[model samples]
Target: MTSLLLVEDDAVIRTSVSLALERYGYHVTTADDGLSGLEAAQTGGHDLLLLDVMLPSLDGISLCRKIRETSQVPILMMSARGDGLDVVAGLEGGADDYVVKPVDLPVLVARIRSLLRRTTIAQPQPETGQVGATLAFGELSVDTGSLEVRRAGQRLELSPTELRLLLEFAAHPGIVLERATLLRTVWDYGWDGDSRVVDLCVQRLRKKVGAERIETVRGFGYRLNTT
Candidate 1:
């Protein structure tokens, strides 16, 4: 049986979710606060985590960051409503997906299955050991295998999405990669998220890797300057 941690302060919601998940063959562990949930995740037993955005202690975003710092255990965040800010916060905090409340039990189960499927396929990434075989572009260096980027030997912290964006731009340096194409290629959104998501990630990446390293063409997409 797959083990899952369900962290929600609402007793009714918690019990219902637990029973539903149990019926679906998941052994669910319940927690009423963010701290307990974080402890459960840190213990290294659960296959997945179901986190509530609000709780009595600590917010879901902070807990998510703590969880991601060590474990890549798939996290699915639940919110009171489909608030975009909450969803984005969850995502930025390393949650794999978000679901709003008043969700169908069957749909929730399906989402859990989908998230687990992705988690099952995910391989552990190698540690950032060596920044070798570096692809040098002007003052920027991207080390693919180590997944590190540096400018003038100063390390830059790139989120997973930002890193993927940097790689795509690096691969096709000096090319006018369109917003649609980049959304499809970098995010695998296949134009679903379109420019907004891609553009946000790109903007963050630019801040990390340095603005000069990435050039924004008016009414067009981005490119590595290759200066």
Candidate 2:
């Protein structure tokens, strides 16, 4: 059975989701607050994470940021409503996807399965955890084999997920890649994959490699501007 980590503050909602997910053939481990969620998340055992954006103790955003630093664990954010800002924030915080409150169990299950598919595909070299054979665009250099990143002679240190994301973008330089496509390929995420994850990672990468390196296609996808 696929294992999952569910983090939510509301007791009733958490219980309901746990039950629903359990019925769908998932082993669910839940946390009531962001602090506990972060702790559980770092244990590094679960297959996917279902996080609520509005969390008590530490807040989901911060926890997400911290986790994104080292692990590429698929994260699915939950919000109270279909609030765009919250969705964006969750994505920016490193969540792979988001679902509005009053979640649809069936839909959520579908998303999880999709994420799992991507995850399994990415597991081709399951034990290696290495990628990005040779990425270069306009002086920016990334060595996936050695996990080395640099731009214009300046060395860059990025989180594991961020490095994979950059490699994915570099692999398709000049061609626009959808946000969801990036999520699934780079981060192993599925379901309602949020654009914010791409947005935030791009923003962070921009700050490092220069914003001009990444082009936003708006409503389509993102591309690396080698020129």
Query: Could you list the CA RMSD of all candidates, in the order they appear?
Result: 5.3, 4.3
lDDT of each: 0.76, 0.79
Error of 1 at 37 (Å): 2.3
Residue-level lDDT tens digits of model 1 in 55-107 = 87888889988987777677888977647787777776777656789657876
Q: Which regions of candidate 2 fall more than 4 Å away from where they truly are?
A: 121-133, 141-168, 177-198, 217-221
Number of clashes found in candidate 1: 0
lDDT of 1: 0.76
**Which candidate leads in TM-score?**
2
Q: Considering summed lDDT, which 10 consecutive residues are worst modelled in model 2?
A: 118-127
The regions of model 1 sitting more than 4 angstroms off are 1-6, 10-30, 44-50, 65-76, 80-82, 91-133, 155-157, 194-196, 217-220
- Estimate the lDDT of model 2: 0.79
* TM-score per candidate: 0.62, 0.73
Clashes of each: 0, 0
